[model samples]
Target: MSTIDHPNTEATSAEARVTSDPVLVSDVVRSDRLLLADNTVKNHVIAATGVSLVPVPLLDLAAIMGIQVDLMHELCKLYDVPFKEKLVRSLLTSLAGAAGTVVAMATLTSLAKTVPMLGSVAGAAGLSATAAAVTYATGRVFIQHFEGGGSLSDFDPVQFKELFKAKIKEGAQVVKSFKPKSTTNTDQTAQTV
Candidate 1:
């Protein structure tokens, strides 16, 4: 019996064998969006409030990456789409843009009819501002969705119970941090009564 050299195995000296791990590659690709969302949220929060909920004293990759990865994975499960994050983000971007444009156009048209001199300028500026605002708002919403986990509505409570619970928890934590520490040391020599 003669054995032929398989390309998948060690081939002739003329060729270099190329190999790949599809699972690992897909995993990394999937993880990247999650990582991006995490960094975006962290950066935005840090810029806005200077507060971070990340576990480490420093905002490192593991905490940020883990939260986003878990969130994305969970969202994928909850959503019916095969690739949830991308689909959801794209939809959000488009919807936000459309809504912004409509509102801007309507407001501008109304103002233009009422104000004679500012008509043309208002229309142009309104469209431009609408485009910019939509992009910014959609990006913000995307980051917020990932950071909040599940949905933006998850952070936005429609019912009072959830809001009240969150407020109570926040208050309790604040009160815990503010509790007074008693000093036990008593010096009689300093009493000059």
Candidate 2:
């Protein structure tokens, strides 16, 4: 048997071999839109002050949080970072306070729906705002970490908590300033018939 020698195949580590892919701003924007839409719908329902509908939006908020976590993973993949599925658990543990608040709000919303007079209250708006803030904070943290040459395995949730909170406050302002899309007047359009 003739043996041919391969040069330095074992020298390169997997981490060193992985190269960054192009992560576009547009992709992030699209993901943000998804998060926003989820928040908006829940907010709108809550704002309607309908009792039976409260639970529906609260349930949706939980689902959206899951989606947000998935989005972080997706963003990590786009930035060529090693996707660590376990990181999600670590993130939740580190941000337990924030995550717990969201859960509490969801629980409250659910309870409000079952109560007689409480269903008509306008507390859902607060929950909606929280949803938006958390989504924004989560995305910002992941993006900053990925951009700083950190991968999922290197992510330290405790170290990033303060930064995440700052981002959450900023994101809350953004959510406050958010304006819905305006409708265009179609009557002025030229007809091709």
| Clash totals for all candidate models | 0, 0
RMSD of each candidate?
19.0, 12.7
Clashing pairs in 1: none
TM-score of 1: 0.28
Off by over 4 Å in 1: 1-113, 147-149, 156-193
What's the lDDT for candidate 1? 0.39
What candidate 2 gets wrong by more than 4 Å, as runs, is 1-58, 98-110, 116-123, 180-193
TM-score of 2: 0.56
**How far off is residue 107 in model 2, in Å?**
4.5
For 1-193, candidate 2 gives per-residue lDDT tens digits of 2223644454445435564465689788657754654454335323322222345645655455565666665666566667665677567546646456655764565555444555634345555666666666777777777666687777787788788778778867777677575655664354432
What does the lDDT read for residue 134 in candidate 1?
A: 29
Query: Residue 6 of model 2: what lDDT?
Result: 41
Error of 1 at 127 (Å): 4.2
